[model samples]
Target: PISAAAFGVAGPIVNGVAKITNLSWTIDQIEVAHALDLAADKVQLLNDLEAMATAVPFLLPEDVQTLNTAEPVAQRPIAVVAPGTGLGEAFLTWNGRRYVAFPSEGGHADFAPGDSLQLRLLNYLAPQYGHVSVERVCSGIGIPNLYAFLRDEKIAEEPQWLREMMDQVDDIVPVIIQHAFDKAAAVPICVQTMEMFAHILAAEAGNMALKLLSRGGVYLGGGLPPRILPMLQAPRFMELFYGKGRFAQLMAQIPVYIILNQRTGLLGAGYAALALDESL
Candidate 1:
């Protein structure tokens, strides 16, 4: 709104509650109000993730997940996905015409990798990670460790140049992914690591969808998917997603979507507050 204000496209900033979730500082709410010249009660406290959750119902069909069928929603569940520091999972239950969404701390849940390769990954990661949680392995901050593991496993061979490139950087997951997609064959190891990581992600997403019985299909939301749309489109995701053996038939009926927009959470939060206000 700052730019809008300068252009006379918007009015003066009004009193509205804003929750600063990512801050470590103890927000003296009253102090912030005085500094911003706003009323104390005008500001509120909430997690940004929570705000993202609130946007669920307000999302356009494209913004949310829709299953394989053209028919209306049958007996099943709805799932929400948001990837930032870690992946966030949420679900909504429909009771007749009314629906309710609930939050979860699933990101902190244990990393359950399927098959022996992933088992090796967990074993390799466990010595350092002790108990591996999803966030510790799958996030922007955590992927470097995975890449290092790949280097050791000979899953992705990095030349002196790339090796030096990675050594200097703390997070190399993006580069690793790029290399995998671009030079997976030329760099056999990067290919394996990237493919394995893709499998792991698909496995995790499938686990979420199945456990939630996400009959509404699965929606992918996060910073990485938008950046890696083509890679995300790889058959590896679909292969792992439907690798549930006998249940594979059931899963195939589910469709998956990648959300490309970044403001989804903000939109969800605003919708939530507005609804809450109206209800009040």
Candidate 2:
């Protein structure tokens, strides 16, 4: 018989109930426990990023691609920054015996431009979204915003055929990314959009590294990173990451990796469940 259950939800958990972000579903601990015929205390819910964090320590070499080769400090804090439909952030801290994963809404935190172009992007978005968060300029949803800003500002010319294709698709991110990767028939605007996206992602990853002092490492997870591995592996991405004025050296020493395992969250949920059972 199952002694406990754990779920990694894409939202905040407050008093054991979670209202999924960008969705209308609500998950309650008591409701889940009753459905599974388990005691309420045996059910645990974690923010999706937190669940991803719990599995970081157990990842095999084959499960990740190293981006930074800095030696990790044993038992130091680790941070996870995932840019999927929205940005998700989490961290793990050593608690004497084991690392404890904690969830954060850092993705929703305010966006701070690191350069003049980014500052212009901020000003361009301010009128539309008064409180523009990093997610506004850095995730899957944010990709189109970048594309539109560039197109409108005439930074890059959007080809007529590409414009027609974008109009047909309900979600334009895949189209943009596809053209960006197509070397033979690459779209200039698409390329520019992805470049800006990569820059924002690197800067934010660096920000998290500094905030938590994650000497253990910083893991980049989610659907997008693996898909755009080439873009991320580019030199410019690391340059923006290491642009943290005084702490540039510290950022360089922090190991950065891309999580290639798609099942990491499931693996993490299993680990969380096992831990809950052991605590009983």
Candidate 3:
């Protein structure tokens, strides 16, 4: 028999109600509790990223690919930065005997360029997107923006074949990523776009780590990270991540891992449900 229920949703939760972002669905804890024959308090809704953060303590050796080998500080805050359709951020902090997950909208925070090129990228985007957030150059949707910037700036030439291919697709991210990995084909523009993407992602991950001082580790979750594993493994990514001046040494000690398990969010939701049951 089900004693409690928990859900990891993609939107903010207010007063036990969640309105899913980019979707036309509204979830109410009272409705869910009534339908499940449980008390309202027994049902809980968490932002999707928070659920992923909750599962960090439960991740197995095979569930992730290590990016850094630094030792984790016991029970210190752990941060999660995921770049999927959009950038999602979350963290877990020790709460007495357990780690409690918290969601963040840090991805929507103002973007600060880490270098000259990025400053140029920002200037190029600001006129088009009045308030360019980190998500503007770090997520799946952001790939095209990077690609277009490089192309228009003449930093890289966009091949006619790739342009034709992009024209045929409704979503250009996969096309860009696929060509970026095509070593034999050597798509310069795609490669440049992906490199920029990795740099921005690494910088943002470092920003999150610094903000929370997540000595427990930083986990990279989301659809994009897994697909671009090679790029993240490249030395350039770590270079950008560790470019925090005096804090560079500190960032190096915060272990980083890329989540490979697709069911992490589900596992986290189950953990949350179990916690709910235990409290009752």
Reference-based lDDT, each prediction? 0.62, 0.91, 0.92
lDDT winner among the candidates? 3
List where candidate 3 sits over 4 angstroms from the true fold: none
lDDT of 2: 0.91
What is the per-residue lDDT of model 2 for residues 122-205, given as tens digits with 9 covering 90 to 100? 989999999999999999889989998998878889889888988998999999999999979888888889999999999999
Candidate 3 TM-score over all chains jointly: 0.98
- TM-score (all chains, Cα) for each model: 0.76, 0.96, 0.98
lDDT of 1 at 243: 86
- What count of clashes does model 3 give? 0
Error of 1 at 16 (Å): 16
Give, for candidate 1, the lowest lDDT window spanning 10 residues. 1-10
Deviation in Å, model 1, residue 182 alpha carbon: 3.9
Lowest-sum lDDT 10-residue window in model 2: 271-280
Q: Choose the strongest candidate by TM-score.
A: 3
- Model 3 residue 10 CA deviation in Å: 1.2
